[model samples]
Target: MAMYAYKDAARTVKILARDAQKQDKSNRYYCPNHKCDAHMFIRNIEGVSASYFGAIHSHGHINNCPHGASNRFNPNDYDEDTFEFDNALLALTMPGMSQTKKELPGEHGSGNAKASPPRTIRQIYSMCKAHDCSDTYNGVKIGKMLLDNRSVYMYPKGVFGWRIIEAKCKRPHFYNSIKKEISLIASTAGEEYTFILKFESEKLFKEIKNVIFLNRECFTVVAGQWSSSGTFNVFCTTFLSKKQLAIIN
Candidate 1:
């Protein structure tokens, strides 16, 4: 069973099982892992549990596919108190730049030099999903600044709609040439929250704009620091790359 699946044969777009229920059944679904060719179908047993994707009997996932091992996100595997921010697994700077190491909890010395390389946007998105978008853990460092949970906004549950808006630019022209903003609204039960993404790249902005324009309902995960002011409205002013944002519908 898997919580996510590719919505198209090209495997460029991913869709959550719960969200897939709203889509037409005629649409094809495939394994989220690009290496896996297993066909998937929605399984929504009315009273048992939430909707999810199940592999067809004749089509099985490949041995090397991560989904083949286990697609469920086990919360027990992650403890916020013990969770240490892995800079190598999370982008602090843009892609292609060398990732710096942050000192682990109760650890001395420069840092772990053998740590793995930074993860892709999809990998970071998967990690957030596995943790249910919890941000109560070791802080994430960008440059010389360390941002705690208070300054971070995880992927909110029940994201229903989003839109792009013009934002004021205050950064130096030589460093930041483009400025765009996207506001995502998520509502679940009786609660509502707006997550904002203020970026400086026309390419990233266009990518997000196209996804929202093409899909009726989509999910987005952004890795950045939240604005210091706001209750229901949370915004980020961090520079973003294509690898820092993950969009699925």
Candidate 2:
């Protein structure tokens, strides 16, 4: 399926809400919650890959009443932080980013930054585009928007050879607990990939074998290993904002 990036959720929510309203014209203008005026309904859930709503009830977000009044909310209204990732992060972790990061060593220091390192051909291209907010690789740039800001803020100066890794906790509260997300998002361009595997403790490899055997993807290990060293071909020349650039800015 063609995935809709998280930033696009606002647009999606409007469409869904309009559809839901069409299902019952009478219910078009009210929140479904019997107590809350049906003000809030599903605007856009995006890749809510998980079946159950995690904390909607606790947060007063669920209400299915057909006639009940509900508040009008657009999924796009909520901050991007509420979702796991934006588009840029998703695109970066694709299978190919690992080799790309490793190869970008020459382009690292070519840009304006004195801190530039040896970057690859791809890295050079992305760094220049991302730093300037140019739409060089549109999808790739959008993907970066999905990444958590903490990881991308330093921009061309901060990340190198990075990839997002899975969390040790099967039931992570949010993507934040999922470590290396910044690195993974940063890896989207010519930068290298780094995957992380979480273990119960810093035990021996044998003790962590259970975790090892459970790897669902190989990049998880490959990216993790590469992340250990700061030596990546692509280095961020400047920090860029994926969200604003993709949508508002």
Candidate 3:
């Protein structure tokens, strides 16, 4: 009774929603009932809980909406609808991050130059925290320095590696080819963090699937974007890996 499909600010556009509600730009969201004219607005159902999309009026035409009256609605369906709507908005809002290329700090040569040593996860985290990370409205600094499609070298020196902690995929894989994964990771200073990794690749995906089947705690190196989160989202993943995971440096 607290979910609806709607457009976001960039008009890109769920829950038991746990994240802090930000500056939501969309004013009107569609009701689940196809024939209902009752629209919804973001409101805090519980005094201290995260905000959800609910009917503006407490007692009115909204009471007739399928989501408003809440006889027996499917939670999965609501989640799916919201996921698709949000992804469309995201595609419109985020720049083509996955298609761009940038130079990293630790590279060695220009002409026939040796490849720079891959920065460990801790090193990357240290650099990002100092330069690229920013504090969101939720009062937490989110990591944004990692490139989406580039190779990220992670070392098993400390507590860094992929560990399946939870599944944060909010949308159906059919909506977009991308897959969302949640894993336990650590920064350079040995501080632990959980992040969401959104990616799409046949080979890498299959490799992860195989590793998951074999072991959830494989100490393999990976490369992908380290995206930040607002609230409910918490998956950061890398699709690339080094041939050898031993820490040579």
Q: Between candidates 1 and 3, which one is better according to TM-score?
A: 1
- Residue pairs whose backbone atoms clash in candidate 1: none
lDDT of 2: 0.26
lDDT of 1 by residue, 1-249 (tens): 566677787877767665675454555578766778887777665343445566776888787454543433222222323333444223433655532223221112122333332244343333343221222223532211221121123224212222111122222221222447665554435444555566566786777656554543445545554453354444444546554554543
Q: In candidate 3, what are the lDDT values of residues 114-139, reduced to their tens digit?
A: 22322334222222221212321123
* Candidate with maximal TM-score: 1
Computed on alpha carbons, the lDDT of every model, listed in order, comes to: 0.45, 0.26, 0.33
User: Where does the lowest 10-residue lDDT sum fall in candidate 2?
Assistant: 240-249
Which ten-residue region of model 3 has the weakest summed lDDT?
A: 147-156
Q: Better model by lDDT, 1 or 3?
A: 1
TM-score against native, each model = 0.40, 0.22, 0.24
**Runs in model 1 lying further than 4 Å from the true structure:** 1-118, 131-179, 229-231
Compose the digit string of candidate 2's lDDT tens values, residues 65-177.
21211211112222223232223343333334344433432232222212222122122222222221212122334323222222343345433333322212122221122
